[model samples]
Target: MTYRADPARYDSMQYRHSGRSGLKLPVISLGLWQNFGGTRDYPGAMEILGHAFDAGITHFDLANNYGPPAGSSEELFGQVMARDFRPYRDELIISTKAGYNMWPGPYGEFGSRKYLIASLDQSLKRMGLDYVDIFYSHRYDPNTPLEETVGALAQVVRQGKALYVGISSYPEAETREAHRILKQMGVATTIHQPSYSVLNRWIENDHTIDACGELGIGIIAFSPLAQGVLSGKYNSGAKEGTRAASSNTTLRASHVEPRVLEAVDKLGAIARARGQSMVQLALSWALRRKEMTSALVGVRTLDQLKDNLGVLNNLELSADEIAQIDEATKDGQMELHPSPKGWLR
Candidate 1:
């Protein structure tokens, strides 16, 4: 069956201008970080992609080290693009990143010019694209000179491999510096992908959100549902195949302590009162800021995708609701993952 996009798809989804750039991204973007990888479930992945496009999600985010085998996600995405997305390429915003541990040996990871350039080359080959809409440095590499990493990112744009550049999980100061460097190189930082959610409010406390606003860089929050914690799915316990229960996932059972579950339960009450699901409330909270360009979400099924898109139905959050959510999560701590160089702290 031929996949024809829904003609009225643009009628509902909201699109926002990315920073000061000419690019306009859907407020809710799809991320292929998980469940769209490996050899199995190829059809399942395709179905999810199809549904996302049909729902007017124009952005698809990926990274080099996303899959279990490291790069399988891009390979899988490549196959899906070749089959379904090739005709609609111009209407899509496809982004990929490097900077995590990929492949063996010294040059396989980090922000070196050598690694970034080579990684995107492999990514392009894997995704079967002449150029990606946006390319990113997955994380800040303290060991590598910021100049080298930023220079490599600028080079990618100049070489026609990527139209825009961005950084993820970088601190506020580093984000400013990266933006400055890219500006000097005649390229503006399109967006900053950060791990921001009600539970994970490091962006607020660390002033990364303020920094991005000051610098006129758009923010796309990943894990806005706090890796499903805020989705109200774990109010009782982790179900089988949930990220918290899966050994391969970053979210562990320990991360979902009783206190956090209590916080989530309270938040769920607020969502129900407002006539929305927990997932939709979490996403809307993330997008409450004007500086936010989009909220990147990953889903395993078509139903989940539809639920996430339902966020656009009511992005409005009253001041009292915000206060209630703050009070609910005030006691909760930001769950920090250990980075390799201890710089993420």
Candidate 2:
């Protein structure tokens, strides 16, 4: 059966301005990073996405190389958009990225003008859209000159292929440089996508958050759930079939160590005091930041989306609760900066 999102769903969502830009993004955005990819479940993805829109999620994030088969997520999402979201196209904020490996050849990746332009064209084709609301350079290409990359992004804006450009996973230094160059080119470098969650504090300590606020760049934090680590779904001695059960090179089976799980347990206790789930506590914490325009997360099922949306109903975090969480993870259970590996898909 086809799903039709309720028009009244938008009433509960809070939209915040994207930096100094006129655009306002939903407080919670959906990201097609893992489950939407080929390795995960399809029906689960559809249910999650459908429920999210019905619960007032206006922004959906994607990338060229998101799926195991590369571009498969966008292709799948294109099908969903055609079947369900076609009527509400103007009400959505869709974004896709390039700069990571897409195809097999050298021209298939990187931030070169040739690669950027061609990749965007291919992404638009896969998504079945003429233009993406926001396009991102997935990562910094040290091999490509910053000027060349920024110029290509500006060109895309001028050509109307994308309304805005954003940078992801760039170091603080490179991010500042890119911001300068993009502004000089007359393109509003509206947003910066970085990883931030209770487990990942690199943005806070590394000045990425402060710099973006000072420069008027809105921040949309990706992986704010820490790849599902902050949801109280996994424990140190958890049995198989959990998120930490799979042992991959990027996120080792042991990454969910005893210390990490211990922190999660303690945090769960704090959440109980507030009458919320651990995931809701984590999402609400991310949104409390000044530079944070939105929290980008992935959902594997409709139940997860509904649970996550409940966080917005209670955004109040007291000073004592904040200090308690700070002490619980004093050693930092998960390190997000200079990420030891990529666990996105």
Best by lDDT: 1
Give per-model TM-scores.
0.96, 0.93
Specify the poorest-scoring 10-residue window by lDDT in model 1.
Answer: 336-345
Per-residue alpha-carbon lDDT of candidate 2 for residues 1-345, written as tens digits (9 for 90 to 100)? 777788788889998999989889999999987667666555666677877888889899999987656788898888888777888889899999988777778788878999999999998998899899999988888888999988899999999999999988777888899999998989988999988888778888889888899888899999787777788766645546555554431354434777887888889899998999999999988998778899998776777888889998898788888899999877655665643133343
RMSD of each: 1.7, 2.1
* Candidate 1, 264-284: lDDT as tens digits: 888888999999999999999
Q: Candidate 2: which stretches are off by over 4 Å? A: 39-44, 239-241, 245-250, 339-345
Local distance difference test, each candidate: 0.87, 0.83
Q: Which residue pairs in candidate 2 collide?
A: none
Candidate 1's C-alpha runs over 4 A off are: 335-345
